[model samples]
Structure formats: C-alpha cells, structure tokens
Target: FAGIGDPERFFRSLRAGGIDVARTRPFADHHMFSREEIAALAADALREQLTLVTTEKDLARLRGSEGVPDDIVPFAVELEFDEPAKLRQLISDHLYKARERRFNTR
Candidate 1:
C-alpha cells in the first residue's frame, strides 16, 4: 500500500530492490487514511499472509493513527548522484545568489 505523489515510482523501487510485490493499493498523494480503511488493509494483508510495506512519508502520516498494524514496514530510500561535488557546488551557488538577492532587496 502506498499514498504518495508517485506510487508507481515507489513500486518500481521495490521491484528494483528485488521485492516481489504480490499486490498493491495506492491512494492519492497525502491521502488521510481512515481507521476503517487501515483496518481493512490490515485484514486483507493478514488474510493473504502478506507483509505491509509503504514509503517513509506515508509511514510518517500514518504514525500514531489507530489500527495501524505494528508490523507495517516503512521503506526508506536514498538518492545517489553521479556528480556529488558538482551538485553540491550548484546548490551552494544557488543559495548564495538567493541570499545576495534577499539582502539586496532588503
């Protein structure tokens, strides 16, 4: 189950990680799942003997919500850049220019 901006991307990531996704339930980005909905998902997973996995963002949203299964796992992903130094320099330059503009405006 996934409630994110690009659930298909998440599914793809799972597949890339060699996880065999037998089924999926996707909701709109940032969808606020109701207790009943969570319960239903839990029931389905339990009945199917499948594990529940979701993205970290969705896990944060569902955190502290009642009926959330204890075994539900949150998948965390990291971004790898081909040119780390170049990306860092670009970001630094952008931030420096933005700061200069802000001060100039002030």
Candidate 2:
C-alpha cells in the first residue's frame, strides 16, 4: 500500500468490494528517502503508535537502506485475476489466514 498513487481510492475500492482494511500508507513513488526522512517517517509511526510499512517493490528500489527501519514491513500486493469478486475474496482469505498464522505462532 505504500509508495503508490491513490491509496485512499484504492482502499475505498476495496471497501466497496467488501474488503476490510485496518490501515494504509501511500508513500511517494520511488521515494528514496534520506536518513533523516527515514527517521522522520519512523518518528511519525512512533507518534501514532503504529507499525511503519512499505511495499516490497519500494524496498527493492531502495537498495535496502536509507531511513527505513528494521521493523518496517513490506506489504506485497499481487493481482492474480481481473475479476473483482474472486480477486478480493482470494486476497482477503490469503491475508486473513496469513495473519492468523503469524499471530498464532507468536
């Protein structure tokens, strides 16, 4: 969800299609932030008491360095189908199961 355009619209579309999104962030495209910028972003996250995250694609572009924190997670969004219902259901199920597995292990 990070480093993409129109994340609000994207979330709205997801909601319209019956998908529930707890949180979202849309960082600038190709956002190669400096150390200070990374610290600022992390500080913002700390202030909100929310985890900082970005897209895996954006991470790839960043050479795995800069202001991004070690705790920052990269959200990978994949489009498997053009059909709306099937796509949403598929993604929702996958992420739900994934999250359950993640927390259950903890």
Candidate 3:
C-alpha cells in the first residue's frame, strides 16, 4: 500500500481485518518511484522484516520495472457485489441500450 492514496486507510482496513502491519509508508496517488528510491524501500522492508504488499494498480504503475523488488506482493481488492443478478442485469441493460443506440443511427 505504497501508492496513490493514504496508506493509513489501507493499514486501518488491514488491522480491522486482523492483519498486523509493523509499519507503513504512504505516497501520493499514482506515485512515481525512482530506481534508487525503490531500492532503498526494498532494503528497508527486508531489514525491518516487513512484508511489502501493495495494490495491483500500484504494481501495474511500476510497469514491471526491475526497480520493483521481488519480495513485494501485489494485493487486489475483492469486488463483492451485493446482488450479482441485479448488478449483472444493470450492466447488460446499459450495454444493450448503448449498442442499440449506436446501430440505430440511420
């Protein structure tokens, strides 16, 4: 949780969800990391024995750069829709309407 948004919220969620985070470093949303900075952060994480877990969006932002250390793990948010059928129906309706309107132009 080291990119784009307050890491505190993530840490709080973790704690609430029963994760014991030793420490955290938050950065601006869509933060750009330099090779040197990444190296330092990686070293710190290893030295402190902290598991580096970040959002998938942040991992993607890194663009598979070698600067990103291997120990860093990508964390993904599980999307839980309240009503799957209703949500699916809404999406289907929106798509259907969009397609109908697009092709109806004569």
Candidate 4:
C-alpha cells in the first residue's frame, strides 16, 4: 500500500471499497524487505492479529524474493473518474480545437 505513491490514497481507496482496516503499515516506494525484516514483520502481524496487505507491485516483487512471508496479500486499485461523460466531452473539444489550429496553420 505504501509502496505505491501516496499511501493515503491507497487507504482511501480501500475504505471506499469497504475494506475496514484499522491501521496501516507503510513502506518506502519500491522497498525490498530482507529475510530478517520479513520474519520480524510477520511475527509482529501474528502477535497483533493483523493481516499484511500491500499493493500488487509489492506482492509481485516480494514473491520473487526469498524469505518473504506467504501470508502477505496484494490489493488491486482502480481509479474512478467523476463526471466521466463531461470529462470525455472536454477532452474531445480540446483535441478538436488543437487539430483545427494545426490544420489551419498549414
């Protein structure tokens, strides 16, 4: 979650999706957890009764590495656009205007 840009954004999306997480564990972007670190975090999670949740990219990389806990899970994130039709129309208008200007200049 924190491995992705804006850890808060990931939490916001999780809440929007109705995943009621009480707290977060943040990691630096593109962080690779060592064997000892993974073991320590996994033990802490077990002690705290918390699940290890992370972004898909982190899970992917972690899976590739040795000594990572198997319990760490990945969550998928999707961005939603507000007033998608209006945004599409605005983009279309901008593209048309730019095209007209380019053609007119020729």
Candidate 5:
C-alpha cells in the first residue's frame, strides 16, 4: 500500500478482510519529499532488501525537481474492484508487467 489518507481505516479494512500484507509505506498526501528523505527511504529499503517504491501522485509532485537521485523507484497504485482478492491479483499483475517493461529495455 502507498499514500493513504487514513492509516487506521486501511489497517481496519485489511483486518476485516483477513489480508496479510507484510509491509506498508505511507506518505503524506501530495507530499513534497526532500532529497534527504528520498535518500533515507532508499537506504532503508536497500538495508531491508525490499523494493523501494512511491506513488504516481508523489512522482508528479517531484517532477521539474533536480534533487532526486537516480536509484529511487516510482510505483503507481491503481484502483480497481473494491473486492480484496481481486484487487490483490490486479495489483500483482500490474507490478509484474511494469517490472518486466522496466527491465526489458536494454
């Protein structure tokens, strides 16, 4: 999961649905993240051996900026059906295709 307006609601919904997602990164809505913030986040993700990602909304905010380093990865979260299982599968498929597209280019 990514930038959520309400963390409690998110957790509650997950609990109600019995979904077991391991990690969640939340950002302030339309957050203007600094270079230091991006670096720290990238370092933490690397330290944990986890994929580093961000939302398209956050990416849009960062556009026309020069401070962001090249290593950070931007991830976009798309909304589909409200059903949990369906949403999970859709996101998984999207990520897989996105990853393939990203890595296949030279």
Candidate 6:
C-alpha cells in the first residue's frame, strides 16, 4: 500500500528491487489512514498471507494511529544524482540567492 503523490513510482521501485508485489492499495497523496481502513488492509493481507509494505512517508502518517500492526514494513529509498557536484552547486547557488534576497529586504 502507498499513499503518495506517485504511487506508481513507488511500486516500480519495488519491482526494480526484485520484490514480487502480490497486491497493492494506493491512496491520494498524503491521505491519512483511518483505523478502519488500516483494519481492512490488515485483514486483506492476513487473508492473502502477504506482508504489508508502504513507503516511509506513509509510515510517518501512520505513526500515531491505533491498532497499527507491527508487521507493517516501511520501504525507504535514496536518490542517486548523475552529477552530484553540479547538483550541489545548483543548490548552493539557489540558497545563496535566496539568502541575499532575504538580507536585502531587511
């Protein structure tokens, strides 16, 4: 299950990692999972004998919810930039300009 802006991307990542996804349940980006919804998902996984997996973002949202099963797994991903130095420089330039503008305003 995934509740993210691009659930397909998450699913694709799982497939790329060689995980055989038996099923999926996607929700709107940042959709808060209610206890009942969690229960239903749990029931489905139990019935199918499959594990529950979700993205880190979704796990953050489910943190405080009651009856959240301990077996639920959170999938974490890291971004790999093709040009790390260029990307770092771009971010540095953007931050410098934003800081300059903020200081100039004062």
lDDT of prediction 4? 0.80
- Report the number of backbone clashes for model 6: 0
Question: What local distance difference test score does each model get?
Answer: 0.92, 0.67, 0.79, 0.80, 0.63, 0.93
TM-score of each: 0.89, 0.52, 0.68, 0.67, 0.46, 0.88
Compared with the true structure, model 2 gives a TM-score of: 0.52
lDDT tens digits by residue: candidate 1, 23-105? 98999998999999999988998999999999999889889988788899888889999999999999999999999999999
Stretches > 4 Å off in candidate 6? 100-106
**Span of ten consecutive residues with least summed lDDT in model 5:** 69-78
Tens-digit lDDT track for model 5 on 1-106? 3454764555455545565545666666555677787777667777887665445556666666776655545543355666999878989999999999999996
Q: What's the ranking of the predictions by TM-score, best on top?
A: 1, 6, 3, 4, 2, 5
Q: Is candidate 1 or candidate 5 better by TM-score?
A: 1
Summarize candidate 3's per-residue lDDT along 1-106 as a digit string, tens digits: 5776777777676677677778777888878888887887788888988888777788787768876777677766676888999999999999999999999995
Model 1 root-mean-square deviation: 1.4
- Candidate 2 global lDDT: 0.67
Position 5, candidate 5: lDDT? 70
Off by over 4 Å in 5: 1-22, 79-106
Which has the higher lDDT value, candidate number 1 or candidate number 2? 1
Colliding residue pairs in candidate 4? none
Question: What global local distance difference test value does model 3 have?
Answer: 0.79
* TM accuracy, model 4: 0.67
The residue-level lDDT of candidate 2 at 72 comes to: 73
Clashes of each: 0, 2, 1, 0, 0, 0
Tell me the spans in candidate 3 whose CA falls farther than 4 Å from its real position. 4-9, 60-64
User: How does model 6 score by TM-score?
Assistant: 0.88
